[model samples]
Every structure is written in C-alpha cells, then in structure tokens.
Target chain A: MNMRCTKARRYLSQAMDEQLPPAVTRQLDEHLDACRECRDFREDLALGRRLLGATEPSLSGNFDWRLQLKLNQALQKAAGETAYPWLEEKPRGRGWAGNFTTAAAFGLAAVLALAMFIGPQGRVMPDDAGRYAGFETSRQVAGGVSDRLPLNRGALAPLSAPRGIQRSVSGSFGLGDFSPNAAFVLDSGWSGNHLKDLATIQELKLRNQRLNNQLYQYQQQISILRRQLDRPDSNGLDLGR
Target chain B: MNPSRDEHRHGSPSAARFDLVETRDEDLIVMVQDGNRKAFDELAARYKNRLFSFILRMVKEPVLAEELTQETLIRVYIHAGKYREIAKFSTWVFTIATNLVRNKMRQRSRRPQLLSLNPAPADDEIPLDPADPVADPSEEIQRRELALVINEATAAIPEKYRIPFLLREVEQLSYEEIQQVTGLKLGTVRSRINRARNRFRQLIKPLLKDETLLAELEMIEARVAEQKDNPS
Candidate 1:
C-alpha cells in the first residue's frame, strides 16, 4: 500500500461522520478508486456504521412516567431542604420532634436561670447568704477547733456587733479586727495574689512577644534563602557540591 | 389565583401562556431554576428516550439503564441552577449520564462475573415491519443472523471505543460534543471511534463474507455506477 492508502483510511472514518473537508474528500475518492484494499475497508466501515445505526433502541413505554416520578421526588426533597436546612439535619419524620427537643432545651435553660436569680425567699440575697451559710457550717463541723460565732450571721447581720465581741471573734477566727490597719493588711494579701497573677500573665505576654519576633526573623531569613535558591547561581553551587 | 383556571375562564389556551414545548432546553433549564416544575418535566420528557437509549447501550441492561437514566435526570433537576449557558444543555446532561454509566461499569468490574462481555440483545430493538413482504424466508433468516452478529460484535467492543462509537453512530453527537460528554480530547475521540469501527469489522468479517452481504454490496456498487452514468 502507498501513503495515499494510509491517508485514505483516515479519511474513510472521517467521511462516515461528514467531518472531512471537501479537498480531503476529493483526494479520498481518487485514492479509493485506484486502491482496492482501501475501497473494501471503506465499504466495511460503512456497513458496520449502518448496522449499528439500525440497532438504535427505542425506549420502553413507561420510561417517561417512571423518570418523571423519580425526578419529582428528588426535586421535592431538594426543595424541602432548601426551605428548611434544619429539616435535613433530622431524619425523615423527625422534624417536629427536633423542634420539640429544641423548645424543651430552651425551657430548661430559662427555668434554671429563673431559679438561680429568684430563690424561694423571692430575693437574690437569700441565695448568696444560703451558699455562704453552707460553706461556714461545713467548715465549723469539720474542724471543731474554734469556739467562734457563726460568721454568716455576723456577715449578714447589721454592723452593730460590740467591739469586745468583734475582738473576741477576730481572735478566735485568727483574723485581725475590722479596723483600717486590719483592712490594709487584708488588702495587701489580696493584692499580693492579684499581682502574682498579673506578673505571670505579663511574663507570658513577653514570651509570646519574643516568639513573634523570632518568627518574624525566621520568616525573613526564609525569604532571603528562597530568593537565593531561586537565582541561577544556586545551580552552580549545587554542581560544585 | 390559579393561572390555568384563570386562562380557561378567559377562553385562552394554557399553552399560550408559556409555550414550554417550543422553548429551548437551556431556557427550560433556566425556568426550572426559577422553580418551574412544568419546564423541568418538559426537559425530562424531551431527553428521556435519548438518555435511556444511550445508557442502555453502554450498560446492556434495561433495568440498570432505566435507573441510571432516572438518576441522571434527577441530578439535572437538582442542579438546574448550576447550569451555565456557555455549554450546551445537552452536553451537560449527557456528561452526567456518561459519568453515571462509567461509575456503574467500574462497580460491575469489581465483580467480574457480573460483567458479561456479551449481553443479551437489547430489549427495545425496533421490530421489523410486518407489512413489508420478505422476498424469501431464507433471506430473512440470513438477515436476522447478520443482525445478531452485528449486535454481538458491538457488545464485544472495548468500553473505551464503544462509548464514543455509539455516541457518534447512534446518538449522532459531534466529535467535540462527544469529547465534552466523555471528557476525552478530540483526537482521542476520533481515534477511539476509528478503532471501534476496525474492531467491529474484524469481528464481523466472517458474516461479511456471507452471500447476502456480498450481494448487498454488489447492489450498492451497481447503484453507485448507475448514478454516475445517469447523473440524476
């Protein structure tokens, strides 16, 4: 076979789909006329195409209805999800149950908040006083070391305790008397704890600032290294290595 | 107001309101995006048979083909809003259908026994017209046998070629459109189709040597010669 035969066979396939240019068509026709092998190849390909085309299957009768039903269901499902995203979060038939669960959760939260704010005495002070009373009672019973008066009563009562009683209570509880000097001492202790916390926080902040500065320096070094590596001279360095 | 009822009350045809049948597939898809159920149904009805035929040929199982066709249309409906006007709507839909067929083929390949190389003849072959009288019973039998050989040969073609071949031959898609559907380059599509044709010729060569086919070829050649002489 000649080169025309090769070109003609390629044109044969293209011609089946009417994809060949007119110039190529003329050349293919001439080649087919002169070449028996190319002509037979063309004819066989044509016959195969025709048979395949003839076998094109018709769709079954119920195809449209079946497809439409499925498509409608899918569209409806998509629509439901779009309308309410929470519907998708719950399984089918559990939509209302989901809402009910949410409502119950909010109701429980509100009830807890109301109980914390408004105790049985209808005042917030009673709740705070009761908590302090529980703590003092636990400490007194557990230790049984001091014959001190209950601090809860003294703390909640009007500031009308006699000075002698206050002094005795302060000695028994190992606390200084409620005087300006005593207040200054307590303030110093409280400030000491607060200052220690502040110092630790400041130390952490300083360390974080140092780390950020180091990170910035490393990043700058990386950028410089990247620029050097990107240069063509880096190739020479590698070759020398 | 109920639009159909209002149209009837005004003594106007319902089709005059929208004229969905005359609308293009892309416009129909746009309408579907705008929540038009009728438009979606129109698109589905238009492509149902063609899509089913393409999938059926690829998978060679009617039930699976039907399922795949339904899934493909459902995907189009769900993703109607994502359709861009740059590509033809038919190309996009066929891409979905082709992908589904490819996935099913992949799944079937996992269980090789289920992947029959030669499936039964498609269920929906166009029945031969009974009104046309046969010249002879023997000739008719030979024609049917020839058809059987053709079907078997087509089924035996490799999936890579068979898809483009059927898309070109039966569905009448252009090379570029076939490329879009199958995601193969234009050159690959053409080469695969050519290889498919050659493979089919090789498989059906024995049948081609039969007397009936030779006679048919002779008649075709004779007609061509007569046409050349007459120049009608």
Candidate 2:
C-alpha cells in the first residue's frame, strides 16, 4: 500500500470508534473510497473489534463471593489502620526507652500544671538556697508584688533535658508542635486563652495577698499575748511564762 | 455535562433525592469518594466483567486475572478519595489496572516460567461467546474456531502492541484514553495500535481460508461497509 493508505489506515480504527475529528473522517472516507487495500484494512480492524469484543468472559463461578471476602478483609484492615499521620509505624519502636520518654513527657506536663496552680500562692516549700524556709516579709513589702506571677522560669526550664524531643513527642501525639510553653500548658498555654488565664492567676495572687495579711496580724497578736504572759504585774500569777 | 447531573455529582443536597443507580459513573465515584461503600459496590458491579475480561486476556490466566481484578476494585475503594474528576472514571480505573498488570508482568519477566507441565484446563480457556450460544450446530463449530483463531492471534502480539490494541478494540477506549491508560505518547499509541492491528489481521485472516467461515466473515464485512456508506 502507498503512504497515504498507510496513514489513512492508522486512523481507520479511530474512525470506527468515532474518535477522529470530522475532517480526518472525511479524509479517511475519501482515501478508503479510492483505495481497496485501505478499505480491506479498515474491514480488518472492525472484524478484530467484533471478534475480540466477543471474547470478554463472564465472571463465572464464585468470583463475586471471593471478591466480597477479600474486600471485607481489606476494609477491616483499612479501618484498623491508624488515622493519625506518623513519621513511623512504631514511633522509634516501643520498649523501655520509649516508655520512659512517654513517662517523662507526661511528668513534665504535670509539673507545669502544678506550677500554674501554686505559683501565685506565694508560699514556697523550698528556697533557691536549697533550704526549707518561709518568707518573713513586712506587710509594707507585700503591697509591692506584681499583679501577674513571675515568669515560670524554673518550672518551665529544661524538663526531660531535651527540649527538641519534647516538641516532637507532643507532635506525634497530635498535641501540636507549637511553642514549648503551649506544648505542655495545653488549653491554658499563653498562645491560647491567655487573657482568661491571666485573669485567673491575677485574682488568686490578690486573694493570697489578703490571706497573708491576716496571717501576719494573727501572728502579731499571739506574740503580744506571749509577752503579756511573760510580764511581771502587781497581782500577776505567772501563767506558764 | 447536564446541569442536573452536575447537582448530583457535586454532592449537593439534591443528590440524596436520586437513587445512586440513576447517577453517572463520575457522580457515583464522587459518592465513593465521600466514603459511600454502596456507591463503590455499584461501580464494582458495573465494571467487574470488563475489568476481569481485560485482565484475563492480558494475563492469559483466569485465577491471576480474578486476583488482579479484585485488587483493582479494592484499590478503587481504598484510594477513592485521591481520584479527582479530571478524567473519566473508566480512564482512572484502567490506569490503575494497567499499573498492576505492568508490575506483575515485570516480576513475571524476571523469573519466567518456561511452561506449564499440566494440560491447560478446559474451564479456563478462551471461551466461546455465551451470548451467541445454542445456535446452528455447524455455526457453533465455526464460531468456536473463529474465537480460537482470534485469541491466538491476539495472544501472539507483543505486549506493547497487544495492550493498546485490546484497549482500543475490546475495551473500545478512545485514542487519548488509550494514551492515558498506557502512559504512551499519542503518537506511540497510534503507531502501536496500527502495528498490532496489522499483525492481528495478518495472523488471523490467513488462517480462516477454509470454505465455511470465509463466506460468513465476508458477508459481515460487507454489511459493515454498507452500514457505513448508507447512514440512516
């Protein structure tokens, strides 16, 4: 066959499928009209299409039954798969080390929570010198305290000794890798709900300050009564001075 | 393409008013994307035979074909969310099937099994047309012979040619659809299909020179030509 016949026949199958543009169909039809060889080739593709299209087998004998079983298993497997995106299937693998890390993360969160609760109370169980002591500040000194508590400083400091890993650990837990303070403080993190937390902590500091004044006054009265008991009076019986 | 069909596909509230059976494949696939298992089953029901037959012919083994067909459907279910409506659902499905078949073919090429020691099972062989069954006794014999010839001719074609050929001839995909499915350039698709059809015609046409079926094939071809020339 000539080159035109060769080119025309390439599009014949497409023409049969109605896939060709109308212009090409017209050209192919014109070519087929002139060329018996190309016509026969077009006939061949049609015959092949009919013959091969007929050979599509029915899905006989338990095909659906087997597919249903497999589909169910696949569904179960998919449902069981974790929805959360993780860097690894077993994030660094579960063992003592992983367990310890998880424990440390929770422990750090608990300490932060405790500090948030107790910081404004102004009652330190221990001092920076590592001595058990109580503050004996004058009432004049008490009025100078700030409305907001001091920076978390020591409470927020290097818990678990690895700052970077803490962020990732919470990240893996879907706690969001925000600022370090937000990581543990969670709902009360400064990045979120800060105004509400500030109001709460400020109120607690004021209440504690008032309670401290009362405690100081009562301590002063007890000291005075002790001094009176110790004093020598004209008709005084020494009552266990 | 219709506005009403658009409403159903876009997951509008009105979509719920229509039975999923009335829904188009693209819309049904949208439902599938929304985690509708029933919609997935509807799609599976529609295409299982086509997928099974295509894979069966490609792999030339019934059990493997069945497995691959199931794999393709399950994948459609599992990854339905990833299917964007940029192409026809059939195109997306065939692309996935083609990938699986390609991978299987690659693995099989490495550790090629030279032959099956046992005789080919009769149940699993290329079957005669069930739709055209219980015909004239002599006609039945001719039909089976034609089917066998066609199957052999097609099986003999090279993989590159055979895939696009079957997709074009059997699955009736457009040239662009064939390109999408095979990841072949459009030029490559046209050329390969032409080559495949050439080989197929050469192989099967010469073999059917027997007196009985040649007349019938000729008549069919003539009717096809007549229909093409005289549009109703």
List each candidate's DockQ score.
0.11, 0.14
- Per-model TM against the reference: 0.55, 0.57
Worst 10 residues of 1 chain B by lDDT: B1-10
lDDT of 2 by residue, A129-236 (tens): 443232122111233322222245443232323333221111111123432544332222121135765765575455445445555567657645543432223132
Q: On a 0 to 1 DockQ scale, where is model 1? A: 0.11
Report per-candidate TM-score of chain A alone: 0.36, 0.35
**lDDT tens digits by residue: candidate 1, A1-241:** 2347767787799888988899778877878878999889987887777666544454556667667777768766754554444447646676888889989999998777555324421321324333423222222222332222222333333233333222222112222353234322221111113465466446545544554555556765764554444332343123343
- Please give, for every candidate in the order listed, the TM-score of chain B alone compared with the true chain B: 0.68, 0.75
Model-by-model lDDT, in order?
Answer: 0.65, 0.66
Q: Model 1: how far is A221 from its true place, Å?
A: 62
